[model samples]
Target: MIERLISLWPARTGAAPIVPERSVAGRTLLLLITIMSFLSAVTLGGVVLMQKSAIAWSADVGREVTIQLRPVEGEVMDSNLRSAVSLAESTPGVASARALSIEESQKLLEPWLGSGLDLTAIEIPRLVVVQLSDPAEADIEGLQRNLGAVKGASLDTHAAWRQQLNTMAGTIVFSGLMVLVLIGAATVLAIIFATRGAMATNREIVDVLHYIGASNRFIAGEFQGRFLSIGLQGGLLGAVMALVFFALIGTAAGSMLPSEAGAQVGVLFGRFALGWSGLFGILAVVPVIAALTAITSRTTVRRFLSETS
Candidate 1:
């Protein structure tokens, strides 16, 4: 089976590598590295997307404040809404304020309350959106105090929601980093074992090279270069697979998920779009994996040679 897989590879054009490139051990290591790289890329891309989405969520929430006007005895909602809007618009650091239409408000409730219900029969509170020029400059306390003067008016800065979002984002990003670290450690260990196996398989060749006064660096370099090639091939393939995987998910998300689910997904991942930064980060995995493979192989080879000598 190994020989058959080896035969699938294009024939070498010149002298063979010091470390046998077409062996079961090499193929296995390549597959392992490919799997590791794929997982790493996916994890990294997910983290980037989540982090960006979280930032967008926070920024959007921060830039807007909400005012809810509850009905009071003998108080007109329209007057209260106008009062709130005027107060919000005149407030320092506020950009604009607008009350949501009854229809729009009904739509917001449609997800919870079935459609076409008589909302007018119920004492539904009216909502006004206040846009902030800059959250840092916004006098939230003053706005809250001023809104307190309006009949049944209350201000919501969404501070609690934003805090929760930040906490969630931080946890997810930290988890992703931990996963990447674990994957790297696993890859390093795999490379070390593969290097040792390669050295053992080519023990006679190594002995001959040493007898000919080849330095440890030279022998290590040979193994390092060979493993580096394997790593590159595996990493590239894995990265491509990961890209395809994300692309498929992005395409499927719109058509496959239910409307509500899709909306939630959009809120979380923004149509599964990994911008240029994410693409670059994924591509960077290939070279990083290759470098790690080369370094691990070289170190393992040197250690083995020293022990034998």
Candidate 2:
């Protein structure tokens, strides 16, 4: 039965079935790279956004300053708080200064402490939240010296928040860059592997072409043409899929975020709008990787044939 099957597999002359060319094109490789690159790009883009949002939130929350009054641990804190408020209101670059009410202090602590916690017995420190017209214009060092004039008062303008924002943004952008680099490397490797496989499988055809006067350049061009199709198919598919995913997720998130935050996201989307850079990257990188793979395989095959013949 095995011998009969083997005999039947041979193409018959004058009635031979037209065998389609053995190709490395089509949805197999294209679809695989398309799905993988799309997912990876979307994930990296989200990481980039998350980092931006974190830094923005930190900056927004700490943009205002706070003044705390401790009246020698026994004296009335209200007198000292009033003095600090008077000082802040008269100071340069200071926009508004208001003493925190009992209710407000409890509101600040409600996230960590339960809603029903008694506050009357506790000697809560008096806090004055200070806003500025422009944070950059606010002389923080000068404000600290002014606060020194007020008895039993200390000023905090969130010096630590700036440092943390820098750290967080750097970490996130660095990670996104690393991921982009890895994706490029993986794409090149995949192309090289697939091209080599196709070359090996078509070794007989390659020898026939060479014998029929096909130059090395012609053979390499043929392979490059096929690989170019695969690269383009994968790249366009990946880019479109990534855009769709980003839009859907961003739309959903916009509805869930607070109005201010939502506005910020919209601004961010506009700022990060896709441009020629992304287009150039896909077109230039994919084709180059494919062409490189094709040329490398052709060189190896030609060298081997020359050595043996």
Candidate with top lDDT is 1
- The RMSD (Cα, Å) of candidate 1 is 6.2
Backbone clashes for every candidate come to 0, 0
Where does candidate 2 stray beyond 4 Å?
Answer: 1-26, 58-62, 254-309
- Candidate 1 achieves a global lDDT of 0.91
TM-score of each model, paired residue for residue: 0.86, 0.73
Candidate 1 Cα outliers beyond 4 Å, as residue runs: 1-17, 101-121, 256-260
Residue 74 C-alpha lDDT in model 2: 59
- Expressed as tens digits, the lDDT of each residue in 1-309 for candidate 1 is 433443464645974557986999999999999999999999999999999999999999999999998889899899999999989988899999999998888889998998989888777888999999989998888888888779899888899999998998999999999999999999999999999999998898788677666789888988999999999999998899999999999888888999999888988898889999999999999999999999999999999999999
How would you encode candidate 2's per-residue C-alpha lDDT over 215-306 as one tens digit per residue?
Answer: 66566666666666665666567766777776676676577778887777665553333345443443444444445444554565455446
The TM-score leader among the candidates is 1
Please state the error at residue 153 of candidate 2 in Å: 2.0
